[model samples]
Target: MVLPTRQNVEKVLEHFNRKDGVIVVKGKELRERDDTDVEVDFRQESSFYYLTGVAEPGFYVVIDVATKRIQLFAPPVNPDDVVWMGYPDSLETLQTKYDVDEALYTTDLDARLKEASAVYTIPHFNLTFKDEAIKSASTEDNDALYAAISEARIVKADWEIEVMRKANKISSDAHVKVMEAAKTGINEAELYAIFLNESNRNGAFFQSYMPIFGAGMNAATLHYNKNNATIENATDMILVDAGCEYNYYASDITRTFPVGGKFTEEAATIYSIVLDMQKACFAELKAGAKWEDIHTVALEVAAEGLIKTGIIVGEKQELLDKDVVAAFFPHGIGHMIGIDVHDVPKYCTSVERIDRPSYRYLRMRRTLAAGNVVTVEPGIYFCEFMIDPVVKAEETKKYINVDILNKYKSVGGVRIEDNLVVTEDGYVNLTTAPKEIAEIEALMAEASSKKRKLE
Candidate 1:
């Protein structure tokens, strides 16, 4: 069910019709994720899928503003299609299901455009369609339709938020499965498979993105997607950061846990610090709060925590002022999550400059507003490149706790992430997964006991 309801399509059609030009939404096929495979997944385009409920690829819908009529362009299924990819759900069913005006074959799109005032298609990737429309019509109104739809998706509606909540719930549950399935002698990919299976079980229609299933120092790498490493219960820690997308809405989550069913004191200390920092960030997540404000506070908390653990010495303010904390917490606190994981419509915006040190790197810099969803993820990673330069730097040498830091070089990293939605008063956390050490240990223990009984 890729197409939205008739009312939803009307909402978009009305928005387009109100303008001078007509809106032409072209549906595209989803290519395989792998670089080697060009096979189509037959999933509908996200924006088009949002407006219309049709999921099959190679379809287009046009709303004529001047005449106020809607038309769908798709290939009529034939015996050949049945012989290849199997029988497609009938186009008549799709039309009635989505409640659109009319359905026609692909051959009619050009003729319809010639009769319409202006053809408004999506931007960037719609190059082929855009060129075709331009060639077919000499009318000046045939222009880009990207801005309006992009603007519409910027502030989420309540329904979109609900869908994201569902995705987040499924993703969080998958993380729990990984926590229970991880054990000594198992490969990281095998442990990650638990998450994949659970996500599929929970109706995760598609993975929001590639799952990051890294263990030990691999966790230190920010975007570690390779799950080939082994999970040794002795000293390794596993970081599973992943999510599932439902109805084009995405959820981003990260939870790090000990591989041996219990966190070592070393891992616990770092984990607790990151956890507390995330909590502090949540406290400041009310409407109108700047993300940079939350990020600044999290860094201060991380610096203070590190001082207490002897990872760094000297006044917290002094260390933070010198930007020493940036060495450990490199990335932004979080980003906007929706149809795309990084859901900012204008990926490259000339927005107001934030006062943060690395303002450009901050993905989501807008102030928290009502109906806007974001993530609060604070992490402390011991990356070799980040820490090594600081330890050997002449200016930062005084603040370095080389002896204590060297003791746990393999302790890896700690990250705790949860999806949040800003409300009128404070905020709502969409993630509903187990995070406490006790809860994770109990689940793993129960699974192991069950395995023993089965044996």
Candidate 2:
């Protein structure tokens, strides 16, 4: 399908507000693995795809700033190489297939570049070919072009939003597959394979990022990917933070549940706290909403829950003021989600970030707007690495109940994440995975019953 990318060009032009130069960026080219000829997977640069909807390799896009006309340049087909690689689309076909005003071969690109008033590109974006005009045009104009494209990408068009929603649905179903198949003695590798198979069979061959399949104490480490351990204990929890890319759009959803079908009491308490954190953040998400405030809401919920569990004893405000809650919930709540999992331009030079403990790691500091898509992920970890600092601190030492913390250490970590599209009134949650305590238990139980019947 031809994406409405010509309108995207117009949006960038509107943001750039410059008519003196031409915008240029190159698409990614096929590359080999080390010395071998085997092709590494190719993904078009997100910024380039935003301008011209072409996903193929060895192409470049140039847009005239004054006239707002788009020109796409393709690699010249080689007859000898075509014997093995097959012929690519003809220039005429490319012009008709993509949303560009003109399509030409790379042979004609340098001449056109020489003829332009000046060229502007995303700063430091490597061109496929060398040209005197391109080198001369590298200046702050390139930075300006980068900013223009990022600004345009922040708000999704209706079609982009739909693609992202489909991505979320596809990945959400994959999460259910993982949840249903999880059991004691199951290898994390097997669960990882199950998720990949489910997503691939549904036509999503590319994962948004490396899949995390941490179980038991492994879950305490955020961004864990050594999914090689066995689920040795029935009392343990599994945290799967994975998603597949549907047509270049991304879905990032994280779910934590019992390794066995049912959560133990201690695991249930921690899981509920993380779920509550996500819900509280969801309540504060909408157009004109402050992103830092949403993050703070997650922190507040985490503080209250930890206190209720008796792991930390102190007033809520004091716990937050002393940064005690951040020890358990170390990461930011979430960030903008789109083409890349952690989408660009979330922080601009105009927006200064909060320097406090809770705000240091936040990926975004801008005001939320309608048509923006983001993830609301909140987590609480029983990780010693995070808690040791708080325990050692003189001022924060009084709040912790060491015996209580040790009791829940076996619970590891719990996190819940969902993709949502911000609207004027509120947000639309695209994730379909079962997250409520009873809902997750019922789903897993049903799967176990089916397995028994098959046996």
In model 2, what is the error at residue 82, expressed in angstroms?
Answer: 0.7
lDDT of 1 by residue, 154-262 (tens): 5677778888989988888888778767778889889778888888888875787888888999999989988899876556888888898877789999998877777
Expressed as tens digits, the lDDT of each residue in 204-256 for candidate 2 is 99999999999999999999999999998877899999999998889999999
TM-score (all chains, Cα) for each model:
0.87, 0.98
Candidates in order have lDDT scores of 0.76, 0.89
Candidate 1 ranges beyond 4 A from true positions: 1-18, 30-38, 65-69, 87-91, 128-144, 346-348, 352-359, 448-455
lDDT of 1: 0.76
| TM-score of candidate 1 against the unseen true structure | 0.87
lDDT of 2: 0.89
Per-prediction tally of clashes: 6, 0
